[model samples]
Target: MTDFWDDEQELKKNLMNVSSTIESTVATAHGFIRPILLDHVQSVGKMLRPALILITSALGEQEVTEDAIRVGSILELIHLASLVHDDIIDSAAKRRGKSTVFAKVGAKQAVLAGDFLLAKALMLTSGKERGMDSRVVSRALSRLCESELEQDAGQGDFFISHHTYLRRIAGKTASLFALSCYAGVALQESEPTRQMLCHRIGYCMGMAFQIQDDILDYAGSSSKLGKHTGNDLKCGIPTLPLIYALKQERENGQTQLHDLLYQASTPLKEKTVKQALILVESLGGVQKAQILAESYKKRAFSDIKRLAHPQVERQLSTLFTKLSTRSV
Candidate 1:
């Protein structure tokens, strides 16, 4: 994989700016509020969203601005808030090898902590210094809530439609990515056409990123993943790998896989999850999901190629290449 830092030195420098801004902004909080907010911020995993803002702005041959930093920080806070809430819902024990807030503080406090983060993000985005339109951020947040509720509603079914799955991911993960790049370009470029292009590029990358994550849940190990493999299956969530495997089973006139998954029990046991993982691989679910991810990556590259700056386009292309094959 390409080294993102060595290849894009300038973007990496700007990303440091974003990181500093996040730390300083959160430091303004006092007492109990500081710890709750800083816990995740202090140990973040992959600042992908902010990097997107900086990279997309660079694609327009523009320097990263204060507005970009402000919006990037706000978006990262929102992303962290979503992770906190997701951990609660998934009953996750560890995140990036540390005790999750939900694991340490219990669900009630975790939920409130997540809400506080969202509130802080909202305040920042709405403040006069934010420069960009607040309505866009508001809509993205609403979509995120709706997608979380949709995922909640779909739980325990074991078989979700592809359309439903796509819509859920679009709202849950892709919306913020799209918003980040759009807001980044919004600060530097006035051309509505270019803004829309950046939005599409980010959307494609986010979708590909989530698909890769779901694939890892089936194909990765605890040491590499920083959490137990097959946790999604244990939690009764149907991701793309399981979705594709189930379809193959039905097409092959095989009922054993279906019975093992849906008819065996509720909240799948570890043994059942292991069996499902084996069956998914045996049925080529992993390969199919990989192909799907590649498709989204190609879509992102299509837009990246359309950018006017050849060097910036090459940088983004290389960045996505690293993202596509990332292990964690």
Candidate 2:
């Protein structure tokens, strides 16, 4: 199948615009903070969220406006802020194959930088240039913060339920995605129904994207992932695969893996993490997680089909396939 982005060359151009806009916007930070902000911009991700915003904004309009690029930049800044904060919380040394801000500048500096980026995002959103609803962004940010806290509190709790796990991801990852989709249509004078449909598509796609990311923790190559494999377990978070594996073990009256999973307070050795990963895989955790991820992908496709524009439908279908199958 042709790549989702293959025919959408305009989306690529729009993304370039988004990147340039982000550079200028972030450069406006305090002089002391400019270098750090520019450094973070260097690791700009695949621009997946911004691309979604640009595509949905141009659905039938056939134009990715300046407002769309501006909105996309705001979304990207918010995402970067979250990553900087997450690196500190996770104590991660590297992201996208480079030392994280926290690792280079220490936690205190990283936290202030993250806060600065978040504030800039809000400031851009409220600017007279676009006048977007700050309440929308604020609500998503609130959910993101709350979910991070919930995940932290639930760490090392092996019995974390499937419902709770899903809730956490919806807040942590999917909320921002939903906001991107909403912004896509909300910027234009589109029908309310179309806007709602786009929002649902983003939420479903985000859930699937994050689930696939979690699956990569066990199945992907660390070298290609640009981070250590099984780091999530080392951090004491019982993700979907581990949760399913433990359930399978219990049904079979197994206790060894359960004992290993409960070591939330103790620092996990690399060997222990490897052993736990092995047990989770041997117990069918990977397979179960794949099935769950597929379910979310199916939901996203269903929502995509509801979009009225044939071009939008085809593009979104290709995007869904790419996201579900990509190595990264």
- Predicted structure with the largest lDDT when compared to the true one: 2
After superposition, candidate 2 runs with Cα above 4 Å error: 1-7, 60-64, 127-135, 264-266
lDDT of model number 1: 0.81
Put down candidate 1 lDDT per residue, 54-85, tens digits, no spaces: 76666454554667777788889889889999
Stretches of candidate 1 exceeding 4 Å from the true structure: 1-6, 30-33, 59-64, 126-135, 264-266
Error of 1 at 134 (Å): 4.3
Question: Could you give candidate 2's per-residue lDDT for residues 212-259 as a string of tens digits?
Answer: 999989888899889998988887777899889988999999988888
Clashing pairs for predicted structure model 1, backbone only:
none
Cα RMSD to the true fold for all candidates? 2.4, 2.6
